[model samples]
Target: MFMDLDALSDIIVLKHVGHGLTVVTAGVDRIELAHPLTEICDLEYSGMVTYAAGGSSVEISCKVARARDEGEPSRPEDLLLTCIFTMVALDPVTRKPVAIPRLVCETPDEEYLFQAGAARSLERRTERKTSLLEVAPDDEESALIHRIWLQQLKYRDRSHPLRQPPNVLAMSRTQLATAAIMQPQYRNRHQTMIFGGYHLKQTFELAFCCAASFAHARPTFVSADPCAFRSPVPVGSVLYLTATVVYTDPAVVEDDEAQDKINKDGGDSESPALTRVHVRVDSKVREMEHGTARVTGQFHYTFTVPKDVRVLPNTYEEYMKYMDARRRVRAGAKSHRSLPVAGRDGPNLTE
Candidate 1:
């Protein structure tokens, strides 16, 4: 997904750089790993501006394909990953959103993609109006919260660890974090900024670890929810990433034998049960002069494990994260249904 952003950043720079506007990643619409590579191989990254709207935001579609070792021509069959991103122009001094170049579709196919992107953009806006962050929890979520409280009450024997339910765990126990000092080697071509891809790679690795530790099994990548870059991190800054298993969807395992098989197989074994894990990674940068840290990026990743597990919130803050993650999961499923399927030419528009 960061590769896509890196490629798409060129378009933003070429179009808006001279206008004295600062461009930043507004959000990631979707990212899907269509196929996973089994061996280390070269990759070709390509991207395009799919839709530019309202003279403020633009949507970019990007893909990663396997690079032939013999320098042979690439094919659609080599496609490995696809992603969609949103970028917005901001006033350099005011840091407020500013107008951007309007998109002009030159061909029928371009117009088709434009319309599709516009629809998706609108859908995202609608979803945000009712997101868990904006409103109180619904009846279903309230019931789940109540159930978690009851479970905690029943298993409050902290001194006797074994007395607690084996399948249930506190959200605090699933937290994992790492920090790094941004260096010149990871700087962007301009020599003043750090590459977004570098941050992405580090964040994903920690998120994977958090999911694995929580599930006690290896996890398969599912999808990433919309992540926004709040600010840009300059070179020589300290970057910190924290990953937490905020929520989970427990799988209905048939028996203990099946559960044991899943744990032994690292969650890759073929089984009817699959638990969905939602992990949130928050990226922050330390301000040396101010002796404080500020959030620079926020990412939400989803993965699947083959075992039954539960993440119970132990505080009000954790409860909010859990509910928001649940909402993101539902929104992601809706996006999957609405997206066009990949075909010979590209995403099948006819569908």
Candidate 2:
């Protein structure tokens, strides 16, 4: 079961399904780096079907772990990354969701996994309705917004070198973007649309750049929020990605200028200072015949940097994005606190 992800083959063949039908990721429910991979080592990967809905949708759980010696069983501590993905079969020509075979659980463990996946899926749908994007800022968020606005107003004029604090940056200044044509090589197994993994890679790279720029230090990835694919990008279409710092969790740190001076007077510090950075990437696609672009995906990434930094929203739109990212960060922290690290054992087949 441990193998290269791309080499994995389909386990189910729906009866009467069209020959050219393709499967696509409906959403990435979660992707968390449980621990860092600090050294070069052989990696093992495994995945299993956790749940299947009435029609085409199914939930899959995947894990990446360090390869163990022969005859040694995998432990939860071996896991490096854990992911949950929702996928659906689609008609190639029409790009519509297609009905597929229903999953038949053959064991009690399988049934448990099925039920757990169902509950998580339902919770995700329910949570979307009341997400930060759909609701107005609460009292505390409003106060935070006003405080950020006041800080920016006082430091708006960069013409004077001392006006802006070194630790704070305008959200607009942290944007990093890229655009590309969806080439034939990027097509998925369906051969009709660009691959979802390709899109994820693009977004992650740009988000990393945005975070690094904002923090002025190399950033280490911590996690990624649930990312939804709104539309499939057809081969030959234009894809545009924009990544920016939407939130920052500033931690106590010595002044960067003072720290640099200390390092210069003495020797470099043994370890780098670190703080959390949140970056969001928005993707849009435009076909050759269309004059406008349509949103295709949204990705949020969390990283840690070696310096204290803050992102201040200077505009209404930026404020909303900032709030959305803030809410996601808090939600992630709460979820992690409730769940056991890795699992009681290793990655659970029933998770």
Question: Tens digits of per-residue lDDT for model 1 on 60-81?
Answer: 7776677776868656567777
Candidate closest to the true structure, highest TM-score: 2
lDDT of 2 by residue, 173-240 (tens): 99998989999998877777887777878888899899988877899998888888898899999999
Q: Rate the local accuracy (lDDT) of all candidates.
A: 0.72, 0.72
Off by over 4 Å in 2: 1-20, 92-94, 106-108, 156-163, 251-273, 337-347
Q: Supply candidate 2's per-residue lDDT for 172.
A: 93
Model 1, stretches more than 4 Å misplaced?
8-23, 40-42, 67-77, 89-98, 157-163, 251-272, 337-351
Error of 2 at 32 (Å): 0.6
Clashes of each: 1, 1
Which ten-residue region of model 2 has the weakest summed lDDT? 1-10
Error of 2 at 118 (Å): 2.1
- Candidate 2: the clashing residue pairs are 76-346
